[model samples]
Target: MGVFDGVVSALRSAGCVFAEEEARLLLAEASSPGDLARNVQRRVAGVPLEHILGWAEFAGRRILVEPGVFVPRRRTELLVHEALALLPDAPQPAPPVVVDLCCGSGAVGAAIIQQAPWVELHAADIEPSAVLCARRNVGPMGGQVHAGDLFDALPPALRGQVRVLVVNAPYVPTEAIRTMPPEARLYEPVASLDGGPDGLDFHRRVAAGSLGWLAPGGHLLIETSQRQAGGTSAILAAAGFLTRTVHSEEVDGTVVVGCLAAGMTQG
Candidate 1:
């Protein structure tokens, strides 16, 4: 068989749904016959294709992704879209401050900058590998990447200055993780997938801490499953944000957006 056919057969046998397309991508990215073989072997072994290719496509951009780093999902683009919508249309005296909390590969933050280059961006993650991978994707765009848990990773000066805070925090219920595809459960860090017992742990933490860091009238957007959208909105509402949930059927993306009252800025 020719190279393309052979690759497709191998991927198909391994249960890859889009084997032909994946074969094309692998063939295109591979440097040589040996490299292609190795790439195919990894995919068949259930390593995420993004890890093998070293990047993921998000918001129409190629985002750098490292092995063991959480891959950016198309569903999280909803957070990016909602955030850009909340930014002031006219130029501000100072650029809008945007934060990507729980940033994985910094894909969401990087996409935000691609569309709105004027915003001051900062991204943070608790995972060391994710923090390093994020730097390569976000640093070149003039965004800062920090390492620490949740809000702690950010600079204190960012408090009450951030206009848009976007998050893709883990929302998978702890027990449901094992049921997830092997590509994720086996390869991605547990910290990137575990969302505590009910899948709202990070959401609660983010909402509770957001008020102090958000500017007056600032917006917070969180990516969540459709089933968990109401719970996420409620968490934000209880934390003093006016909340709404938005979903895109095309992408199967759902986002809960919360806006602080215009005069509610805090230190």
Candidate 2:
């Protein structure tokens, strides 16, 4: 048997769900046998398959993802689909401002901008590593990326001017962390996956700061868990937003949309 036969057997034995496909991707990405061995060893050690490939296919685009960065999930495409539905195709009668908070790989904003080229897209993240990765994505698209906590990273002038605020922050509960798979538990950052006690920490912050930045009738769409959707909607409703929940059973994803009515908050 060749080296790959042993590697494939080892990967399958380790419980990789797609050992054959993974082997192909690894073999394609590796420059030599040494590199292939290293990547295979990392996969055998339980690092995410996407992390080993160095990119993820999201919204039909390839997003760069370093080892430590949060891997973009297929479920998050629901949030992107929801945001696209909320906005007009960018040859907008007038250009609109867009913000993507907690933008891990800048995938959401980049997807929106790609669909609507007239968008003035901006994205932010609390983690410096994510921020760096997002820059690689948003920068090429003429989008700006800031690194800081929530609205703190957004421009002051964007206040009451944003037309779409898309977010996919961490919503996994603290207590649930222990139950996650070894790849997520060991590879992803605690801050990127942990969402405090009830897992609405970022949702709470987003609701509190959203109205201040949203123009009259602007919308904020956030991805949350199905179990937490009701509570998240309540929080947004209390913040004076007209709220609704959109879910996709296929992806097992849920998103809460909060809209600021025109003249309800500010002109």
Candidate 3:
């Protein structure tokens, strides 16, 4: 049998759902047969497909995903949709300023930039690994990446100037970590997945800081579980935002959108 056939057999036997497709991708990525075997072994060992391939396809774009970084999910494309829909209708000379706080690989920011060519994009993450991964994807999109806890990483100049703040922060409950897939539990950082008791720690942090970063009429869209959407939305509302929830049944994604209330904490 050929190298690809062997690899496909091994991956299929190991529980890969798309054996042939993965084999094809591995073949395209490997420079030699020896490397292909090693790569296939990693896959068989349960490494995430994106980690094995060193990249992930998100929002129709290839994003660089490194080990120890959260892999952007296709479902996150819903965040891009909500952010885009929040754009103001008026024509402006300069592109809207947008920030992707807690950006893992900056897929949301990169996708937003791709969707709106003129948008000024910025992304930040607390984890050093995630910050590096974000740079690989966001930098190419003419976006700047910063490393620090959520809004704190942004420059003073951007305060109250963000037009659309898209976030996909860690929202998985702490106790539920034991239930997560091994790939995430073993590979990703605890801070990237453990969202305190109720899974709204990061959500609250993001919502509270957004009021300081968002411009008048700006929007913040944060991804959360449908079960937690109400609590997440309450955080935004308590932070003086006019809030609403947008859900996508097809993808099982829920987003809590927050708009800064009129005359709320404005400079």
Question: Best TM-score goes to which candidate?
Answer: 1
Candidates ranked by TM-score: 1, 2, 3
**Winning model by lDDT:** 1
Q: Give the TM-score of candidate 2.
A: 0.95
Per-residue lDDT of 142 in model 2:
90
Q: Which digits, one per residue and each the tens of the lDDT, describe model 1 over residues 107-162?
A: 99999887888889999999999999999999999999999999999999998999
In candidate 2, what are the lDDT values of residues 1-267, reduced to their tens digit?
A: 777677789799989888888888888899999999999999999999889888988889998888778988988989889988877854766679989999988888888888877888999998999999999988999999999999999889888889889989989999999999899999989889999899999899988888778988899898998899999999898888889999999888899999875555652
Candidate 3 Cα misplacement greater than 4 A, ranges: 88-91
Q: By lDDT, highest first, what's the ranking?
A: 1, 2, 3
Any runs in candidate 2 off by more than 4 Å, and if so which? 1-5
- Over the stretch 1-267, how does candidate 3's per-residue lDDT look in tens digits? 987788889999998889999999999999887888889999888888889889998888789898989988877889999998877445479779989988988889988887786778899998998888888888977899998888779988998889898989889999999999877888778888888999999888887777778888888889999999999999999998899999998777889998888887565
Q: What is the TM-score of each candidate against the true structure?
A: 0.98, 0.95, 0.94
Candidate 3: C-alpha RMSD to true structure equals 1.8
- Candidate 3 TM-score over all chains jointly: 0.94
Native-to-model Cα distance after best TM-score fit, residue 128 in candidate 1, in Å: 0.8
